[model samples]
Target: MSTFQAPKGTYDLIPPHSATYLAVRDAIAAPVRRAGYGYVETPGFENVELFARGVGESTDIVTKEMYAFETKGGDRLALRPEGTASVLRAALQAGLHKGGNLPVKLWYSGSYYRYERPQKGRYRHFSQVGAEAIGAEDPALDAELVILAHDAYRSLGLRGFRILLNSLGDAKCRPVYRAALQEFLRGLDLDEDTRHRIDVNPLRVLDDKRPAVRSQLADAPLFRDHLCEDCRAYHAQVRELLTAAGIAFEDDPTLVRGLDYYTRTTFEFVHDGLGSQSAVGGGGRYDGLSEMIGGPALPSVGWALGVDRTVLALEAEGITLELPASTDVYAVPLGEEARQVLFAQVTELRRAGVATDLAYGGKGLKNAMKSANRSGARLALVAGERDLAEGLVQLKDLTSGEQRPVALDALVDEVRKALD
Candidate 1:
């Protein structure tokens, strides 16, 4: 019989490497938690229309990459490919906008799925740390989210990332810009799909990454050139705030993010170390998304940091986070009586807040010591019938190869002191 394997384009987080993923998630979440962003979690799947209506049906995430399926009851559902739409749906369902506190600040960390060709940084199953400030429209709010993400990466000792910023003009001015961009795009020698995209989301045509398509976009109408006075002013304020906070960013004219709801203030975190799939995280101000998804008017801004990509970025920089050992003390028992006694001591040590583990299956002294060493523990407690008869246990320091005997009753205290 053949053992089952993980599905293609996906992976199971395993071992000491899984620990790094956890540390990355925690590091990204810490700044958001400190900034009053409360934790929120939504289902892994949702009505297919939520993303179609919110993330834009024309985007590849909806039309090409979504893992959409029909359930037994004939309900259309899709595993969440991105976070903002689902998060907004949850906030609307809970009526969070009605509470008068303005933007309901929330943060979440979870695995998001997309049926893409798996590669180094891209995966069919990926994880993201998302934060949203819903129901408010403030440039400071946008800047706050960006600064928090910057601080998160900095706290992780990352120094090779760049922030690319832009403003995709708001409703008041976007329509006029859209018309001009469509006119310019229609004149280009484009393919059928690219031509169709021109009629649907014209701005995205400028985002086409194909060398053939990009060469023709050299003179495409710039969004900023058409920005109305209010949008221009709002964009300016967001830039000013980021500069004031000492967060450096580049103004990329064609940085229209892959979503339909975004309007005004858009930004992305890019790590040069990860070739091709360089975006580590990004989000923008979506002033009309709440109404689009059947909720009251909620102008919001949020971002999702790709845990997988961020981890790759860390590796690209050769950074290793100092992680605490899984086991602080490993107990090795030589006999059945010592096993029972040490088992009880292990429980007590754990209850007393010491990270402890024990050897099992009657392993001999040498083999048990090897197991103890592999537990990533710095200390080991070895007890036998002879040692217990003398009312003591042998404590060995794995690091310095030192050994001493401690009173049986004082095992926990002695371990704690030695660890301290």
Candidate 2:
């Protein structure tokens, strides 16, 4: 027989460590909730074509990184490698866009999967806090999404992070820019794989992370150069609004998003702390994804922040989150009768919103006290034969090492006040 373990790419968030994870999640998602973005959850996996069409077949996620399997019923599904496609699919299926809400604001937090070479800040399974605003094309919406992500990072006590912004030019102008980039890339000294990218998605060639490839494409034609009057105007307006709102960003000429659906505004959050894997999260506007994935034309924009990467960034910056202790009281019972009565009292204390726990095994007084200490509880409630006979329970303050006898009828009140 062998001991079981969690899957290689997954992890079990346990004990005091899990408290920090939760705190990070809450801090990141608090603003989205406050801004009236209702919570929405989609399936962990969806039909494979949903991502294939929406994320682009040439991208790494749909071609190699996706975890796809066929069900017994002959449906091909894949664990979501990202959040936006699944969210958009759900919104379309539910007819949320058809009801004329104009812009349906939603926020979600959950795990996303990708089959990547595991390393620090890059896991096969990870978590993200994402938000989407569907059915609108206003640059203000783009600004709003960017600001929300900026606020989340700032709220988490993060410093030395830069927000990079770019406009990929919209439908009317992107095709022209693509043709110019393709022509320039074709004349370069490149490999067959890099050349193939020109035919499939020339814009992504600008996103190449390889040193050699980046060096070659440094002089590549700029998308901003070929932007039509309308697109150029829209991009200008988005920049103007961000400036007015005091959101600073750099205009990177070659900033092409990894996804195929993105159009117009694209952004990324980068931290200086992490050495190699520095991108904390990113997203952009996908104006035509709805129509591309068998739904009515819906223009939407959103972003997803990697919770794991953010935590690593926090660690890198020495920002320690002091999570509160798990327990306020530990009930230690000596005899069988005392255990039963103490169990009932523990239930009552919990029902009244107090964090309480109890010793499970029949342990000696010293051992029970040890368990109380290990629980991080500030106080302990002990009920023994002698104390019960006297119609009282012994209360011990673990911090002060002081003990007092409290009447049984007033135990809950006494404990509550002392805790306060």
Candidate 3:
């Protein structure tokens, strides 16, 4: 082995297994595309202040987990810890919100970095397929995002996952609840850092996972009880829309997403099969994020599904994705002349939309056939010097162990027919 390794908390997705990752991402993204969310991509890193302001400076993501650094030119940049801020920043900079239709819908998939202690389902470097609908405040948009996410998981055959729903009160009522929560938190016996979070973001205290913190929080004030009329109405409409769509969800009063900008509807998708890192993916409506990031008041809703964690959930559920073979035809060429002839035919087959692989390095018939079997190709194309002289090749059905001679000129058509 080489004396090198992927950085701690990161993984290399290689080979046959990587196919599953791609399939998962596609499954998650399909529904959003069907719903008219156009695809968007952005740089993996962005100006540090964008996240600090948009994702919340008080949250652990900015304060501790963000992989922040100063550039040689004195510009501070951070690898994106999440997708929303960068996506919104890009949308704002490109004036999509101003030029396009309201609720500029978008979908993105890529890696996000965080400097956290790694655990199962919680990697420092992870992949996500995300969707965003910017510039709309309709609760239908919120329900659409949630329904799309749920549909994605189900499409991947993921079961036993629950969508936890909550509404973090909007600007008018959140402060009142924050003060009451801080008052209760301050009177409890807590560590200094936990106490400090109370002042910086009292809502975060409710999300603490430790039993000690969670136990004390049992009596804490909830945002549902304090939501202003507008926020309450907004939350009710979102729930109604979800119910109308036949999407089931549990009301989670404690689901204060680890972001400060979530104004009304917030949600998390959890699976008990994932152990402590139970959250497979989660996101919520960040109606105030655009203004916080120096853009106009564009209300938006979105969600991100973890690609790696979804693969884990699939494994936990004993579900296997029915992935197609990487190669449809494996060509085993027998002599130098036959190799040259079959290589051209292989190229033609590939051009005809057949997934084809050729045996290289002049492997023997046995070894070449072995390689063909290993490739999971359905058919093996074999041509010896004698066969090439006869202007023909042998097409072997690897599955049924049947072989037949076909005209070399008609090879491409034969392979296409077999594959179809």
Candidate 4:
């Protein structure tokens, strides 16, 4: 028989490596929870049109990257390529934004699938920790989302990250900018696909990395220059709020987010140390997303941080997170009677909130002690038949290798005190 491994571009997080993934997740979620954002979970897949309309039909994600398929019942579905669209769909479906609260604050952490040509830091499937503040259109809300993302990155001890901010302009001014940008793009001697992109989403033309296109784009129309009065005022307030909160950012006119739904304020967190796959995570104001998906005119702003890319960025910076110990106490029992007695004792320890684990199989004392050390346990509880007969259990401080006998009744308390 042959054994098949995890599919290419997909990874199985196991053992000590899985520990890092969990640590990263907890670190990112801690600040979000403290910010009064409740956790929300949606289905892994939704109707294909949900993304095609919500994420924008013109963006590469909906057109190329999505893992979409037809169901046996003939319904078209797609594994969510990102979290925000699904989250918004659920919030709208549940009527969370029906004037109950101004902004329905939500934070979610989960896996997202994107069928791309997998490369370093880019995969077929990945996980993300995203947050959305829907139902509000205030500029301070945009600043708050940026602050939350910055806090998440700082909490992970990450440096070398630059927050790039831009305004994609609202419906009031974006149409004018789009026409001017398309006219310039049409005059260039571009490939058929590049020309097609101009008709689909001219702003994505700025996102192209090709040297020739970039050289020609230097003369492209700037969005900041064409912003209408309302968009200009909104952009000014968002910058002011960010300044008041001591969050540093760079205003790049060329920073066009990939998705079509994004409008007005757009931002991205980029890490220079991660090589070409430098975009750790980013998001922006999707003011028209609700209406685009056949819902009411609900405007919102949010961001999604890539957990996998953030981890790689941390690694690239040589930052190591000190993972908590897996076991607080390793209870090793010798002989059958002591095993049964210690099993009961460990249960009590666990009830007292002490992390305790015991040897699964009957290994020798030497082998068992080795397991204790490997678990990163601070204390090892040793119980033998002779010690049990005397109503005593031995406690060995793994760090000091000092062994002492304690009364069975005092075992839990003694271990707790020793740990402290």
Candidate 5:
């Protein structure tokens, strides 16, 4: 074994499993791409204040989980703990808001770093495929994002997930609700840290998962009840649009996301099979986030689906992705002379768009055949000095255990036909 290992709370995706991660990412990004969301990529790290101000200092992600550090130039930077803030910063920096298009749509797939005590479905380094629709406050946009996420999960055969929806009243009423919630929480018996959170961010206190904390929150004021008239109308329209599109969701009055910028619509996608870390994905409208990060007041909505969690969900629900074989054809050379010719043949087959692999190190026919079988290839191209001399190669149908001789010139065409 190598002396060094992957960092704690991190993993290395290898071989067949890595293919599944790619498929999940592509599956999640497909609907957004088709909807005109251009792909955007940002640096893996950004100015620490971007997340501190945009993601909210009170949230655990910023306060406890962020991987922040100082550079040699004395600038504080942080590995992005989440996607939206960095994405929004990029849009603002690029001046996408100045364009005529109301909402600057974008999609991204990459790894994010956090310093959490990792467990199942949570990691220090995780991957997410995210979509952001910036510069719009339309309820239809919110509904569209939710529908896209739902479609992505369904397309991947994830059936046991449910969407939880809520509204955290916007600027007009959130302050009033915050005061009420803080007042209610202060009266309860809470520790100094928990009580301090009520002053810093009262909504996060509601998100507390501790049994002791949750037990006292039963009668706490709900933001949905305190939503302003405009926010109420907006929330109602979002729900109506979702219903009209036949997407099912439950109104979760207590579903406050773990961010400070989210206002109006807030939601989460949960799968029971994931145990304690049930959230597969979630996002909501952040009408004030642009301004929070020192940009123009551009309203935006987006969601990020966890690639690792989605894979786990697939396993929990007993769904296999039915991935295509890694190799469509495996070439086996029986002798030294056949090796040179077969290597050229393998290259030609691959150049012709066939997934062909070659058995190297001069294995005997039996061992090479075993390697071919293990490759999950549907067909094996076998050639010996005798066959090569005859200007032909032996093609074995792995599934059917059938063999035939094909002219060397027709090898590529025959393999393509067999694959098709």
Candidate 6:
């Protein structure tokens, strides 16, 4: 019989390599954790209407990409394509917003599902570290999230990514720009679907990448030009803050990231080395998302750093993370008596805060020694009836190829001392 494998467009994180992924996740979440953003977790799936209403019906994520289904009980649900809507939903449901904190800062890390043709850096299921500052709208708050994300990438030795910044205007001025943009798009020689998209959300047409669509949009209306005074000032403050912090950014007039909740500031992190799927991650201010999701008015800003994409970015830059050894010691037991003795010592070493592994299956010394070497351990413990009878065990330094004897009673202390 053939063995079953993981479904297509998915992957399993195995040892050695999986360590790098963990380190990447830690590096991305570090800055957010230090900034007082408490961790938040939501179910893999939520009401399908959450994305439909909060992510916007006009988005491809809602119209196409999302993994939605009806439960056996007849409730409509979806595996979240992104984080903001669900995070905000959780905060509101738990009354976290009702707390004294104006913008209830929260961070999340999880796998989000979307059904799409998987490619390098794009997956049917992907992992992300997301941060949200809900219930407030301040340029400084917006600037802070961007700065934190910038610091995150830098912390991991990533320098090839660029921050693409823009403002989508707000309710006060977006309708005017939308109408003008709609008029401009309606005049183009577009397909039926493209023409219909202009009526639903004209800004989306700006994101069209086809050469034919791009040629016509050359003179299209820009959000930067239509920004109301308030939005302009808000965007200017965010830019100034970023500039003052020595973070460089490009003003992308047409970056309407694949979301509908974004209003005012919208920014994306693009790594030039990643090609085509250059967006490592992005997020922006969602001032109306709370109301759209049936919560009280709460203006928010957030960003999610793609763990998988960031790992790819690290590779694209030819950088490898410094990951610590998983096993500090490997125990080799030659005989049944020695096995029991070494097994207890292994437990003792572990209890003393030492990372220890045991060579199982009664392998011979040569084979067990090979196992120890493969474990990336600094030390290998070997014992037989003779060594144990003498109240001693062989502690071999794998790095230096030096062997020594230590009293069985003092084993843990000796291992700790050697490791330190």
Q: What are the clash counts of all predictions, listed in order?
A: 0, 0, 0, 0, 0, 0
Deviation (Å) of 380 in candidate 5? 0.6
Deviation of model 5 at 240, angstroms = 0.7
RMSD of each: 1.1, 1.7, 0.8, 1.2, 1.1, 1.1
Cα lDDT of model 5 by residue, 49-101, tens digit: 99999999989998899999999999999999999999999999999989989
Q: Would you list the clashing residue pairs of candidate 1? A: none
Tens digits of per-residue lDDT for model 1, 302-419: 9999999999999999999999999999999999999999999999999999999999999999999999999989899999999999999999999999999999999989999999
**Model 4 compared with the native: what TM-score?**
0.98
The alpha-carbon deviation from the true structure for residue 8 of candidate 4, after best TM-score superposition, in angstroms, is: 1.4
Reference-based lDDT, each prediction: 0.94, 0.89, 0.92, 0.91, 0.93, 0.93
Instruction: Indicate whether candidate 3 or candidate 6 has the larger TM-score.
Output: 3
lDDT of 4 by residue, 1-420 (tens): 449887878888898888988998898888878888989999999999999988888788898889999989999999999988899999899999885787889999999999888899999999999999888889988998999889888988997899999999988899999999999899998999889999988988899888988889888889999999999999999999999999999999999978888999999999999898999999999989989887788889888889899989999999999987889999999999999999999999999999999987998899999999999999998988889989999999999999999999999899989999
Instruction: Give candidate 1's error at residue 71 in angstroms.
Output: 1.0
Quick one: best lDDT, which candidate? 1
**Segments in model 2 whose C-alpha atoms lie over 4 Å from true places:** none
- Model 4 off-target regions past 4 Å? none
Backbone clash total, candidate 1: 0
Itemize residue pairs with steric clashes in candidate 3. none
TM-score of 2: 0.96
C-alpha lDDT (0 to 100) for residue 138 of candidate 3: 94
**Consecutive 10-residue window with the lowest summed lDDT within model 1:** 200-209
Candidate 6 colliding pairs: none
Q: Per-residue alpha-carbon lDDT of model 6 for 1-420, expressed as tens digits?
A: 549887888888998889999999999899999999999999999999999999999888899899888889999999999999999999999999887878899999999998888898889989999999998889999999999999999999999999999999999999999989988888899999888898888878898878999999999989999999999999999999999999999999989988888999999999999988899999999999999999999999999989999999999999999899999999999899999999999999899889999999989999999999999999999999999989999999999999999999999999988998
How many pairs of residues in model 5 come into backbone collision? 0
